[model samples]
Target: MTTREIVQKLWNLCNVLRDDGITYHQYVTELTYILFLKMMKERKQEAAIPEKYCWDRLRALHGEEMYRHYRELLTHLGTEAEDELIRQIYHNASTNIGEPKNLEKIIRSIDDLDWYSAREEGLGNLYEGLLEKNASEKKSGAGQYFTPRPLINVMVKLIDPQPGERCNDPAAGTFGFMIAADQYLREKTDDYFEVPKLKPFQINQAFTGCELVQETHRLALMNARLHGIEGKIYLGDTLSSLGTQMGGMDVILTNPPFGTKRGGERPTRNDLTFVTTNKQLNFLQHIYRALKKDGKARAAVVLPDNVLFQEGDGRRVREDLMDKCNLHTILRLPTGIFYAQGVKTNVLFFNRGTNDTGNTEEVWFYDLRTNMPSFGKRNALTEEHFGDFIRAYTAEDRTQVKDPRWSRFTREEIRAKGDTLDLGLIADESLSAYENLPDPIESAEEAIGKLERAAGLLSEVVEELKAAEGGNRK
Candidate 1:
C-alpha cells in the first residue's frame, strides 16, 4: 500500500485502541517506536539480530503471547537505551494500548507500510500528521511545534534560501521551517534531483536546528533523517548558547518559545547576556549576535502583539530590531490560528546588518487576519493565503523597492509612537475618523449597528437551516 494509505489505515485502527483513558498522541508515539524498529530492521536487510533487540521476537508471537512479549520487549529496549524519554514513551505506549489485541493490531498496521517508498514525501507527510496530532493533544504543549505552515512558506520564499546558504532554526520546533527551507531550495535549484543534490553555492551544511524538549528533539532528529539530512540538529536550548553552538548562519528561521521568565528561574547563568523576563526578547538578541557580519538572514518570528507595542525592554528590542536590522515586514495574524486559544500573533521579517543608519525604507504589513476568513485547526490557514505577501516581498529585490506590502516608515513616525514596532498603516484623516468611530464609548451607539449586522447574519443562518430541514423532511 501507499504510505498515505498505510498511515490512514493505521490512524483509523487507532480508534479501536482508544477508550476513556487513551488519546491520539499516545497511539501515534507508540506507532513511531514500532515504525522505527520496522524501518531499521528493513534497512539492515538482515535477520542478524543485534544483541540489543529484534522485531522477529514480537513478529513471531501471536494473540495474548504476542502482546505480552511486545510490551516486555519495548520495556527491555527502553532500559537498554538508558534514556528517560524513551522509557516514558514506551511505558506510556503500553499504558495507552493495554490490550494484547490492540498491540497486535498496531504491529500489523505498521507492518503494512512500504519502507522504500516511505523515504520521499510519504514519510514527511506521515510525520507531519503525527506532529499535528501530538500538538492537538496539547499534553506537552507540543502545539508550539506548529508554526503555521503558510507563514513558514512565505518566510522561506522571501528569504529565497539557496543550496549554499546555511539555514538554521534555533528553538526549532519539529524543524518545520528548516525542512521547508530545504525543500524550497531543492525545488527551485537544478542540483537536487530525486534526493537533495547540494550545489557548491548551496550551503553544504544545509540546515541546523536546536530543540530543548526530548520528544521534540527525537522527532526533529527523525524528521531530518527521514528527509535524508544528517547530523545538523542539536539537543539543547538555542538562546543560552546559540552563538557558540551554531557559529553563524546565513538564514535563521525560527519562532522562539513565548512567555515571560520568572524571578527565581532563568534559562542559564552565563548564557543570557541581557536582563529581562522575556525569553523571546533574549532569543531575538541572540539571533542578532549569531548572524555573521552582513550575513543577511530573514527571520520570521511569531511574537505576541505586545512585542510590537510594549514599553521598556520590549521597546528596546523593537528599536534595536529597527535600528540594526532591515525591519522589512510585519504580518498581523488573527486570534485562534494557534491551538492555544486566543493568541493574536504577528510575524516580524528582518535581516541583520552593520549600522543603524537608514529609516525603515519600506515596511510591508500584510493584513491577512483582518477581513480574512475565520480559521481553526479543522480548516487552518494554507499556503494560498500567503501568496500576496510572498509576491509583494520578492518584488522589492531585497535592496530597492518602490511599492509592494511596502510602505516607508520614517524614524520620527516610530519615535512619536513610543518606539512601537506596530507597522500598520498610519491612517490618513478619513481613515482615522472612520476607525475612531469604533471606540468603546461609541460602542453603545455602535451596539445598534452591531445588532443590525448580527440580525442579518442570524437571519441567513435560520434560512439555511430551514432549507436543510425542509429538504430532509421531504
Candidate 2:
C-alpha cells in the first residue's frame, strides 16, 4: 500500500475507538504508542523496549490478557526502560481503550499494513500524513498544534535554513517547522552524504525545540526519530526559566499558541523586557532575543492580528522587535486556514541585527489575506497560493514587483502610525462597492449565510461562558 493509503487505513481504525469514548486526538496518541513498538520491531531496533513487553509479545496474547499486559508494558517502559527516549515516550502514558477487543482490532489493523511500502515511502512521511489528517478534522482540535503543511513549507523555503546552523521552535507543535528545515537541508546535501563531515552536527544539533504538552512532546519526539533527527526536543514550558537558557540560535521558526496565559499571569522568564499575558507577544520577544546578533540570524513567526495593533506593551514589543532586528516582511495570512477559523494570522519575517539601533530602514508587507478565497477543507491553502508573495520576497529589486498585493513602507512611516505593524491591504473593491453585485436574491442568501455563521459563533461563546460559570461554582 502507498503511504497515503496506509495513513487512511490507520485513521479509519479510529472508528473502533469511538465506543471507548476516545477522541480523535487521543486516538492518534494511542496509535503512536502502539506504532512505536511495531516500527522499532520492523527496523530491528527493539533493544530499547523490554523483551517481555515488546511488540511480538503484546501481539501474541489474546483479548483480556493482552489488554492487561499492555497496561503493565506502558508502566514498565515508562519507569524502567534503559533508553531515555523510550522512557520519555511512555512516561505517564496510559491506555484509553476501555475494551480489549477494540485494542486488538487496532493492533491487527496496524500489523496487516504493508510494512515494505511504508518503509519505502519513509515512515516519517506516513506519520506526518496521519498528523495532517487529524489536524484537518475541525472537531479534533489538533489543528492548534498542527500548522498547515503548505504554510510550513512556504516559510521554510523563504527562510532557507542551511546545514550546521542551529534552528529552533519554542512552540514546536509536532516540530513541523524544524522537520521541514531538516528535509530542506537533506535534499540540498543528498541526505548529508555529499557533506559527510556535517552529518553528525546536522542530525544531532542542527534542530532543537521545546513543547509544553507532554503528549504533544511525545509525538514530537516520535516525529523527529522517524525522520532520523536526534536533536533535542525538550518537554517543558518555554515561558519559564527553560526558555531563558535557549539563546544564540541561527534561525528560529514557530507558530506559538494564541491567546493570553491562564489566570492572566505574565511569563515567569525575567529576561524578557516586556511583561504581558499575551502569549504571542511574549513569544515574539523570545524569538528575536533567541537569535544570534550576527546580522545573519533570522526568524519567521506566526502571530494573530491583536499582536499587530494592541496598545501599550504591544507597541513596545513591536518597537523592540524593529530595533533589535530588521523587521522586513509581514505576510498577512488569510482566514479560515487554521483550525480556529475565525482567527486571522500573519507571518513576521526579520533578521537579528549586529547593532541593535536603527537597523530597520523599510518594511515590506504582502497582502495575501485580502481578496483571497476563503481557505478551508474544500478550498485548501497550497504552495501555489504563495507564488506571488514568494516571487516578491525573493526578487532582486522588490520595488520592481508591480503587484498591488505587494507594498512597502519606510521606518518613518511605520513610526508615524505609532509603530503598528498592521499595515498594507489595497482597497478591496468588492467590499467597498456594489457596482458588480449579483441579483438581490443572491445577495440576500449571502447575508443570511453570514448571519447563520455569526449565530453559530455566538452559540459557542454562550456554551463556553456556561462552562466557566459552572467551574466557578465548583
Candidate 3:
C-alpha cells in the first residue's frame, strides 16, 4: 500500500484498539514499539533485536500466546537489548492491548504495509501523520507536545535554518520543530539533489533535541531517524544539569512545556544566576545561554502569557533576555490553535547579543489572537492566518511602519514598563461593552485558567518568602 494508505489503515486500527480500553497515548506508545521493530526487521537488522521476540515471531502468533509474547517482548527488550535505541524505545514500555485479537490485528496491519528506509520522507511522513492524529485526539494529553504545523512552518521560515548549522530543541516533545527544520532544508535544496549534496556528517549531526518523557522521546528518536537524521535526543528533565550541558546552537525552535514547576524544587544547575521552580523561566534562561555570543545564534520559542508579565522572577528573566539578546518580535498566538484549548501563547523571536547587554533597540508585536476565530478541529488553523505576520516579518525596516495589528516597542518603553514583553493594541471586546458576547462558559474557563496560574505563582512567592525568613532566623 502507499504510505498514506498504510498510515490511514494503521490509524483506522486505533478504533479497534480503543475497544481494548487503551488510551490514545498508550496506543501510540505501543504502536511506536511495534513500528520500530518492524522497520528494523525490514532493514534486515534482526540481530539488533533478539531472535525469539522479533517482529517475525510476533507476526506468526495468535490468541493468548501472541499476547503473552508481546508483553514479555517489551520487558525483554527493556531489560536486555544491547542497542540503546532498542532499549530506550522499550524502556518502561508495556502492551496496552488487553485483547489478543487487537494485538494480532495491529501487528498484521503494520506488517502488511511497505517498510521503506527511515530516511525516506514517505515513511517518515506517514509516522508523523499518526503523531498528528494522536495529538488531535486531545484526550491523551498528547496535544501539548505537538505544536500546530502551521506555526512550526512559519517559525522555520522566519528562522530559515540551513544545512551545516546546529539546531536543537531543549524541551522537544516528539521533536516537531526539528522535523520541520529538516524538511524545510530538504525542500529548499531539493533534498540536496539540486545543490551539492550535504556532507554525510551534516546530514546526521545537524539536529539534536532533549525530550523528558520516555514515550515521547522514543517517538522523536524514531521520527528523526525515519527522516534520515541520526542525532541524540536525550531523555531527561531539561531544567536540571542537562540545561547547562550544551551551548552554541545556530537556531533553536521549541515550545517549552507550559506549567509551573512541581514540588518547589530549584533547578539543579549552577550556571543560571537566577533560579526558580518556574520551569519556563529556567528554560528561557537556558535557551539564551545555549546561543552563541557572536550574534549569529537566534531562536524562536513558544511561551505562555505569564512568562511575559508575571512579577519578580518573570521580570528578572525578561530583563536578562533583553540585556543578553535582541528581543525583536512577539507573535501573539490565537486561542484554541493548540489542542490544549484556552491557552493564550506567544512566540518570542530573538538573537544573542554581541556582548552582555543592550542589543535590543526596538521590538515588534503582531496581534493574531484578539478578536480572532476560536480555532478547533472543524475550523482548524491554517497558514493563511500567518500571512500578514509573515509579510510584516519580511518587510524591510518595520520600525517605520504603523499598523494596528503591527506595532513596535522601544527598549526604553519596555524597561519603563518593568521589562514586560506583552504589547498589543486590540482590546478584549469579549470583556468589554458589546452587544454580542462570547459563550459564558468559555469566558469562565479562561478566568479559571488565569486564576490557577496566579495561584501557582503566588504559592512560589510564599515559599520564597518563607525560605528567606527561615534563612534570617538561622
Candidate 4:
C-alpha cells in the first residue's frame, strides 16, 4: 500500500478504538507507541528495543495473554529500557483498550499492513500523515499544536536555513518547522553529500526545540527520530527559566501557544525586560533575544492581531523588537485558516542586529487577509496563496514591486501611530461600498418599519394580559 493509503487504513482503525472510549488524540498517541516498534523492526534497527518487547514477539501472541504482555512491555520500556529515546516514547504509557478482543483486532490489523511499500514511501511520511489527519479533525483538539503544513513550508523556505547553523522552535508542536528545515537543507545539498563534514552537525545538532505538553513532546521525539534527527527536544515550559538558557540560535521559527499564561501567572524568566501574562508577547521577547547577536541571526514568528495593537506591554514589546531587530516584513495572514476559526494571525520576519539601537528603518506589510477567500476545510491555504508575497519579499528591490497587496512604511510613520505595527494599506473591495453612508430617507424608513413590528408584538401581549386580568376579576 502507498503511504497515504496506509495512513487512511490506520486512521480508520480509530473507529474500532472509539468503542473502547479512545479519543482521536489518544488514539494517535497509542498508535505512536505501536508504530515505533514496528517501524524500528522494518528499518532493522531494533537494538534499542528489547527483543521480547519487539514488534514480532508482540504480534505472535493471542487473547488476554497478549494484552497483558503488551501492558508489561510498555512499563518495562518506559522505565527500564537501555535506550533513552525508547524510554521517552513509552514513558507512562498504558493501554486504554478495555477488551482483549479489541486489542487483538488492532494488533492483527497493523500486522496485516503492507510494510514493504510503507518503507519504500518512508515511514516518517506515513507518521506525519497521521498527525495531519488528526489535526484536521476539529473534535480531536489537536489543531492547537499543529500549524498548517503549507504555512510551515512557506516559512521554512523564506528563512532558508543553511548547514551547520542552529535552528530551533521554542513552542514546537510536533517539530514540523524543524523537520521541514532539515528536509530543505537536505534537498539543497544533495542529502549533505556535498558537505560530508557538516552532515554530523546537521543530523545531530542543527535542529532542536522545546514542547510544553508531555504527550506532544513524546510525539515530537518520535517524529524527530523517524526523520533521523537526534537534536534535543526538551519537555518543559519555554517561558520559565528553561527558555532563559536557550540563546545563540542562528535561526528561529515558531507559532507560540496563544492566550495569556495560565491562572494570570507571569513568566518566570527573569531576563525579559517587559513582564506580562500575554503568552505571545512574552514569546516575542524570548525569540529576538534568543537569536545570535551577529547581524546574520534571524527569525520568523507567528503572532495574533492583539499583539499588533494592544497597549502597555504589547506596544513595549513591539518597540523592543524593532529596536533590536530589522523588523522588515509582516504578512497579515487570512482568517479561518487556523483551528480557532476567526483568530487572525501574522508572520513577523526580522534579523537580529549587531547593535541594539535603530536597526529598523522601514517595515513592509503584505495585506494577504483582505479581499481573500475564507480559508477553511473546503478552501484550504496553499503555497500558491503565498506566491505574490514571496516574490515581493525576495525581490532585489521591494520598492519596485507593483502589487496592490504590498506596501511599506517608514519607522517615523510607525512612531507617529504610537508604535503599533498593525498597518494594512489595502482597502477591501467587499467593504468599500459600505464605507459610504446609506441615504438618510431610506435608513429612516427601515428603522421605522422595524419599530412598527416591535409595537405590533407589544400590543398583542398587552391585550392578552388585560383579558386574563378581566377573567380573574369576574
In order, candidate lDDTs are: 0.66, 0.90, 0.83, 0.91
Q: Count the backbone clashes (under 3 Å) in each candidate.
A: 7, 0, 1, 0
lDDT of 2 at 83: 88
* Higher-TM-score candidate of 2 and 3: 2
| Candidate that scores best on TM-score | 2
lDDT winner between 1 and 2, please give it. Answer: 2
Pairs that collide, model 4: none
What TM-score would candidate 2 get against the native? 0.91
Query: How do the predictions measure up, each by TM-score?
Result: 0.76, 0.91, 0.86, 0.90
Residue 331, model 2: lDDT of 97
* Residues 242-298, model 4: lDDT tens digits: 997689999999999999987999999999999899999999999999999899999
Compose the digit string of candidate 1's lDDT tens values, residues 211-325.
8776667677666655545546777776554446785677888888888766635556255446577788878877765666573655667777878887888887777777677
Q: What's the lDDT for candidate 1? A: 0.66
Q: Give the TM-score of candidate 4.
A: 0.90
lDDT of 3 by residue, 16-84 (tens): 876778877888888898888787776566888888988888888888998888889999998899988
- For candidate 1, report its TM-score: 0.76
The local lDDT score (0 to 100) that residue 79 gets in candidate 1 is 60
lDDT for 60 (candidate 4): 94
lDDT of model 1 at position 438: 26
Clashes of 4: 0
